[model samples]
Target chain A: MALNIVVCVKNTPSSLSVELDPSGQPKTAGVLYAINPFDEYAVEEAVRIKEKNAGSTVTALALGPDADQTVLREAVSRGCDAGVLVTGTEVTGGDTLATSRVLAAAIRKLAAAQPVHLVLFGKSTNDSGAGSVGGQVAAWLDWPGVLSVKKIESIDEQAALLWRMMEDGIDKVKVGLPAAVCTVKEINEPRIPSLKGKMAAKKAVFTKWTASDLGLKPEDAGAPGSGARVARYTAPAKRGTGLRIAGGSAAQNAAQLVDTLIERKLI
Target chain B: MNPQGILVVALNQRGQASPATWELLGAGRALADAAKQPLFAVLPGGTAEQARELVERGADRVLWTAHPSLKEFNDEMHTQAVCAAAQQLSPARILLPGSVAGRSLACRLAVKLQAGLATDVSEFSPSGMVKRGAFGGNLTAEVEFKSPIQVMTVQAMAFPPAARQAGRAGEAAELAFAPAAARTEVISFSAEEAGEIDLGGAERIVSGGRGVGGPDGFKAVRDLAHALGAAVGASRAAVDSGWIPYRHQVGLTGRTVRPKLYVACGISGQIQHLAGMSNAANIVAINTDPECPMMQQATISVAADIFEFIPLVVAEIKKRKGVPVAA
Candidate 1:
């Protein structure tokens, strides 16, 4: 039986641009854009799932402005069968709740066309690291979802066994069929796209849809639909002024370090 | 009306709840009492018995959905059930222990609910700001969510486990649910069962890194830990290089610990390594690098070769504790 899988992909600024301007809030501009690295793991997992099941198709679904296609194209190159761009001004500045609702509506439409068997997302977005969208999407679509999956335990038509990375060790959990899963970087190495795949993506058309297209109200697609707000973004605290030890043998350095730790009551 | 309840999602395998679930419930009780909210536990299985044990601990209610298909953790199905319960109950806050499954589930739920989420939170003030490790655990970050429903995953060992208090009995609420068919299925799962207890719950940990040299080097570290009655730990580098089993690795790629004492032997502190144990009550370092970052973070830093220092330190500790030291 042919199965359809959708991987939610997003492009985010590679790293936060931090600056101090009197106030603690960092200057947020001048950030570079790249495919959310963890999402690449999701795309790779989706492609691998399709490969194993045989007769399965993988679609990369993204919600962003025009520039976001950079990640979608990257996914296509990695072996996604097609891409969907749910884009519009309506979704601008939407928080995770709104974002999930919009994506869930889009998935609903896609499901109508091909019957989506599985949904995948990265564990968290770099910008916010909120890591909520996948779970919210499962709720929006009323499906079972799992997050931070480090290893795919098993996959069959009936269910999927997975190992989730925790603060301590891995937790073995099994999910029944038609589940949604979020991937973390520890899961797998994302494949680099071939030249042929790149060319194919360039020619492939992204199915662009707006909130109206998904029968969602405008308010339900943007900030008003969001569950949380970002009051401000700030830089992380500075490290302790680094201490340089004078020239010494390894033993000497170790002794000095120990002395310092003892003074600090660290050891 | 305490409309805002404390919600916890319990993870089970086949039908038994993992030990972490109890730890979470213990934490949940504290948060619930603080917030003046009821505590509800959600567990997935074919029967409510999977979560019955929580009632004896402090859970006011156990919302369960028993389905043959829901026996395993299908994220989609689990999320659906938990979200349904959350929506129905409208909890003001959700507490998930910062375990692998907890972090994953919490992140997904935050996105699903469009709520604010903080991961690996070591300290959370009543105010929204949370203290989390940043820059490889060399520093801390204060994260505040602007959302009404705050979702947090507490780091393991960050808070002491709460003793059981007299609370209402746990009531199991069966749900109308089913697990989504997963694209992948578990073919098999094989884990290396460590002969020793899990390090996450250890009171003291003695960790070695690449600087320890080779397999033989670890024997000394192990002997020291045994002498100290502490668990053994390893850095990611040691595990990746096959110097030690992954179960022994301690760092961002490994386990996070907040033991009473942590001793690093022959390991130069990497940002990732510190992230795992930065919260320990006291840290001791034994490395040749006087300028090594770990030395700066460690309260007790020793500048010596492990081969040379191990015998002396072990002998001293043994002498003080009135134990025999290996010659």
Candidate 2:
């Protein structure tokens, strides 16, 4: 059977060079956006699995504003067969739960057209890094989900063997097919878009879906539906001025450090 | 409905309450006291001993549920158990540890309860505001729950564990709840051969980065840590290069450590790495590059080859302690 994979991607500020508005939200107006760094790993992993499996199709999906189309386009450029952009007022500014709900609804809609055998996501987005959406989506779909997956040992029609990174060590999990898998950076190196692939991505037709298109109401998704809101933003406290200890050589420096530690009784 | 209490979801490992559980109680106590609400603790598969320990640590009441299937963490079952407790208790807020298991379970519970969820929260206020690092610690944001019920996961080491008072006591009760059938099963759990040190409580840490060269390079790091009685740590680069195990990794994606003294050897200090150790009381950096971020932020910056510097430091420590160096 041909596998149908949906890779969820997010568009975030290109870098930490962001200006917070008076209300503490990142000012998005005219700011550069790129595919979330982690999501690129997910996209790469999906493309690899597609290359390995015959007749497999990878559909890239994103839930955000029109600027998020750039993320989907990047996915297509990296070898996704199709792209879907789910946007509108009801899908933006939502917390992870609300975002997962909208994405789950879109995945359901996609499954209606074609049975989805697998869903993929980055371990977490760079901006938020909550790393909860994939599991939330799996719960919404009633499917098993695995996080921080670094290796895919084997895959067949029924189940997939995966190696997940854990605090103590690696967990080798056997997740049944039609499950959600969140990829870590160690999984694979993302490829740059080829010239031909870029051209194809530019011409690719995107299926845009609104909240209503996915059978979701404004209250069921986005900021209105979000359970959490940012009340304020503040810069992290600055560390004390670092002291640069100098010495003539390594031994001298080491002695200075040891003497200081002894003086302060820090050791 | 009147806010009933602040509920803490305790985590367990090999039948004992994990350290994160105690830390959550510390934060929970403050939040509960400020809200003028009771503080309740629930363990999905915890034992009576663990429940009693929580009471000693400041829990007003403890609720525990246990089953053979619950012994190992199954997200589906854990979420169901916690949600069941939340539904019955009607807590205004729920606090969980932001560990791997906690984050996943917290997300599922938020969906099940349709509550506001925050992850990696480091600070909490009685007025329902939480502070968390965003953009890899470059910025911090204060968030609030729009819904009646709120859920959040506290970062490890962000709060000290509650003091265990000898005479402190509270009520303990068994939570009667049934868990759903699990969709996934753990075939086996294999731990890495290297004994993992608990970095959360380590007073000092010696961490190496990619500039440490390779696995062999960590020998010096280990020797220095052994001399200083500090835990050995690694940056993401070193860990990703397979030079060290992930358990020893110190960074945003790894363990967050707040030791009194942090000695970084050969680490260039990416922002992600800083996010984990920036809070350390005193940071000492040894690197060849004078202008690396770590060197700039370190309380004491040593410009030298770590391979050369670590040995001298270790020898100096040994000599000062009256231990004869090996010939």
Which pairs in model 2 have colliding backbones?
A: none
Error of 2 at B133 (Å): 0.5
Calculate candidate 1's fnat: 0.20
Q: Label model 2 with its docking quality class.
A: medium
| Model 2 backbone overlap count | 0
DockQ of 1: 0.21
How far off is model 1, as Cα RMSD?
A: 5.5
Off by over 4 Å in 1: A1-3, A13-26, A50-56, A153-158, A161-174, A184-187, A192-207, A233-267, B5-90, B104-118, B128-150, B164-192, B196-236, B239-260, B264-277, B307-319
What is candidate 2's lDDT per residue for A1-267, written digit by digit as tens? 578899999988877656788777787788778889888888998888899999999999999888688888899999999999999987888988899999999999999998898899998877777788998898788788887788888876688888877655577778887888888777877999998779889999899999999999889898888899777777787775476777677789989989988887878
DockQ of each: 0.21, 0.67
Task: For residues B1-327, write the lDDT of model 1, one tens digit per residue.
Answer: 333887877777546665666767777887788877788877766365555566766788877777665565555455667888787778877877666556656756776665766677777666656776543454455765666677777776777664454544667768766545543333344444554656876778889999889889899889878766788999877776778876677875557788887888988887668767877777777788878888876666666778887766566656656677556
True contacts kept of each: 0.20, 0.72
